[model samples]
Target chain A: MKSNTYKEYIAPVVVLVCICLVVTAALALVYGVTDPIIKKNSKATADKTRTELLKDADSFTEYKGKLVVEQPGAVYVKDVYVANNKAGFVATCVTKSFGGALTMMVGVDKEGKVTGVKVTNHADTPGLGTKDFEAGYLSQYKGIGELKATNVKDDGQIKFITGASVSGSAVHYGVYAALHQYKDMGGVK
Target chain B: MGKQSRLRILLNGLIKENPVLVLVLGTCPTLAVTTSVENGVGMGVSAMAVLVCSNIVISLLRNVIPDKVRIPCYIVVIAGFVTIVQLLLQAYVPALYASLGLFIPLIVVNCIILGRAEMFANKNTIFDSALDGIGMGLGFTFALFLMGSMRELLGNGTWLGIHVFDKFIPGMGIFNLAPGGFFSYAVIMAAVTYFAAKKGAK
Candidate 1:
């Protein structure tokens, strides 16, 4: 019985712990080698998306001053990039969609016109809320320089995606927040 | 196992005992990713890398791993490989990485990886275990591709996001949704099961 106990319990536990330690060491080495590459790739993608959203801008420079967010409620400006030649400003923004947070970059021109918007990260439900990030839904925001970002339900002229009011509203609020930051930083001038 | 039987062991994973169809394992990732062909391929290839690596490692350590703690030991090795694969994906193929997104990390929990590790890898030689991983992985990829192509063609009127059909009439929108995912999965599952049973009867 004592031998059985040793074999069944203590033996397995010892073997398993040794295996775990070895695996963990191996993983640490692989992670060390790959982590820098991963960091570089993330930066590359972020750069690519930022450039795509502000295509017409001659160049972009980071805006470090405080961004006044006129629109409150789940909207936030994570970073602001201003285009050279007073062209436009791109705001890396985030807001809550139906399923979760939607992170995007919104480019607004000096005339307060939206040049482009690209969703960088989102956890919205695939079919239900993610459709909001597609070209058809996002195109509505582009060049809608007239009204301050207001929900279409409030008669702001922009039509929210059908059956996905929360997701649509998230983008609307993100754009609204971006514009307020742009104005505060002399982007419209 | 003889050379011919060894060949049979590898072939077993591809169709006769396909992880996705015959065994009907790891159906969630299969269904969720088949919305688009690209996503399916990305998920399949990633899982394949992790599976092959983990399988070989487990097989090598099979004797050393005690039976009582085998499950935990297998999990640690599998998860380690998965994290490495994910890191590689994130670093090198950022596009594929983005498309696969949350599913990449979720691959750690995928039953097929641990299932193969426990069933085939621990019992087999290193070369055979590696072959099993490759065959199972390919079978999974093939199944996912078929489901993705059918769904994409019907649901979006596109193949790999290219608008191939429905220039006029819209495609079946339902195929892209959750219910559509289930219907597609069930239809394919039924087809495979039926054919396998027929072969058995014959």
Candidate 2:
């Protein structure tokens, strides 16, 4: 009877615990080796993205101020980097889009004008939601000082893709959040 | 089961017990990642790595593991291998990692690995189980490659990002959608079934 109980309960428990320990040990070994390389790769990508968005800036330092944007879950500021050359401030903002969160970088100059805009990561629908993210569409944000309204229907400053309003407005709000973050920081201070 | 030779065990997964086309396991990643050849191949190879590793470990531990908690043991082992593959991909091959995205982590739940662990690995010797892993992995990869080629070629008018039919035949946009995935999967499944049936009759 004791042997039966051991087989039914104790044996399984011991086996499972041992398996868990071995798996965890293996995972920790792999993670320790790969973590640094992953971090380096992402940092390199971020640096490259920063240079692309703010062409004239030679270097950037992350803005130290706390981001206090009160927008809902759909839009929020991720990070803001200030250009040392006074070119502009690059703001990374994530906004809810068609498929999922759309993360984009918007560079705003000291004069409160958009220098450039680039999408960093997004799960937006390909072909449809991506229509708004085209170089032609995103380029319109360049030289525009500020947005007056939330979407294309209200704000004539930006022209949206005909069938992708959700994505378009998502991007519009992303840019809005970035610009708002820039304004809140009061330029390169 | 013991009567089967090593070569037959290895080759069995290619057609008779194919995880994707014949058995129709892991349809989620099979459909989701096959939109592009690059993504499809990437996902296939990644999943194959996990499957092979998990099968070997599960086979080795089959005798030691208690039958009552074997499923949970298999899951922990499979999930461990998946994370290991995920980390390695992120560190070494960032491009493939980025393209594959959420599907990488989703491999943890892939039924093929668990199915093999339960069905083949536990019953077989270590060498035979490893061969099964390789055979099944190759079959899964081959299936994804075929589906990815068809979808990428028809939908994007390109093969592996190279412009193939673009100059002559315009891209069929529907082939890039979810419906297209199901359509292609069904068509290929029917063809495989037809040939498989013919072979069985012979």
Candidate 3:
């Protein structure tokens, strides 16, 4: 009876509970240290992208007022930055992409031409829709006077990624939305 | 019950019991990350670290773990090692952490780690268990690297994002797609099978 109680009831539970306690304690200790580093890494990446978007500008001053954009497929106009040297304005924007959401920075120069578009954060299908996020595709927005949805299939200039059309559309749409906000802020020039 | 040579135990996992090619385990990650050479190597090294650590831990505790709850205990232990690996990757190698995002967490469920713990670690000495983990991990790494190289070279005409073919011919776009991944995997699997069969015939 003692052996049965020890083997059947007490011992297995004790082992499992002990293992769980050790693992949980270990994970808690690790998370405490890594959380801060992860936060810093993400912040550094964001700062780098913002800088890239407005590379020529000496400084970028974010508009400290409420931003509300009621455009289709546009998530939000998260922030608007004006170049201190008056060279350009970069609007950080977000839109729903394939897997989750794509956040990008669209830079418009003094000529009202899109100087650059950079995808800052995204959770899209890796190879399919992600192809559109590449510089080759994103760079197509550079120097364009107006943000237009272009797909080679429709005889327009740009070609939507073959397999991930929805994701491709989302990125272009997000950039266009950011451009619209830039235009609202006195037409980039 | 009898003694097994350490070298034979180590070599057994490389080919005879290769986690990917022969044992046909952990195919999910093998396919998912093998899309690029860098990703494949990153994942392989990360998994190997977890595997070796878990093997040693499990072997050391083999006697104390109650038989009835050994599987659960093994999972908790493996998961601990996996989380540590993930945290280290995220903290120090954020580039790899970003590229391997989901796969890094998914290593917790990877059959190679759990299988080694159950089949080898629980029954073997710590040193031998570590060897098995390494051999199997390397074999898995080799299989993934070959797949990634073939796919990258053919699909993108590049190696590790550098232009390799230099417009010799436009890349076969399909190789970068899911169908391409499956096709390349099938080709590799067939080759491994064929060579293994020929060796067996001798």
lDDT of each: 0.80, 0.84, 0.79
Report how closely model 2 matches the true complex, as a DockQ value: 0.52
Docking class of 3: acceptable
Query: Alpha-carbon error at B106 in model 3, in Å?
Result: 3.5
Task: Report the poorest 10 consecutive residues by lDDT, candidate 3 chain A.
Answer: A147-156
By DockQ thresholds, what CAPRI class is model 1?
medium
Estimate, for each residue in B1-202, the C-alpha lDDT of model 3 and write its tens digit: 2356787777787777789877888988777777678777777877887898999999999998989999999989988888888887889898877776656676888899998888999999898899888888888888888888998888888888899994788888888777888899889888988988999999
Cα deviation at A35, candidate 3, in Å, is 2.4
Query: Over the stretch A1-189, how does candidate 3's per-residue lDDT look in tens digits?
Result: 999999998999998999899899989999999999988997788667767876788877777765647454557778888888888888888887776767888887877788888887776535556778888888887887764452234425566668777777777766667767766776543
Second chain TM-score per prediction?
0.92, 0.91, 0.89
Across all candidates, the chain A TM-score values are 0.78, 0.80, 0.76
Candidate 2 stretches with Cα past 4 Å from truth are A68-74, A97-102, A111-115, A119-172, A186-189, B1-4, B92-96, B99-102, B167-169
What is the Å distance of residue A77 in model 2 from its true position? 1.2
Ranking by lDDT: 2, 1, 3
lDDT by residue for model 1 (B9-119), tens: 778877799999888888878877677787677778878878888899999999888877889988888887777777777777777767766566768878999999888
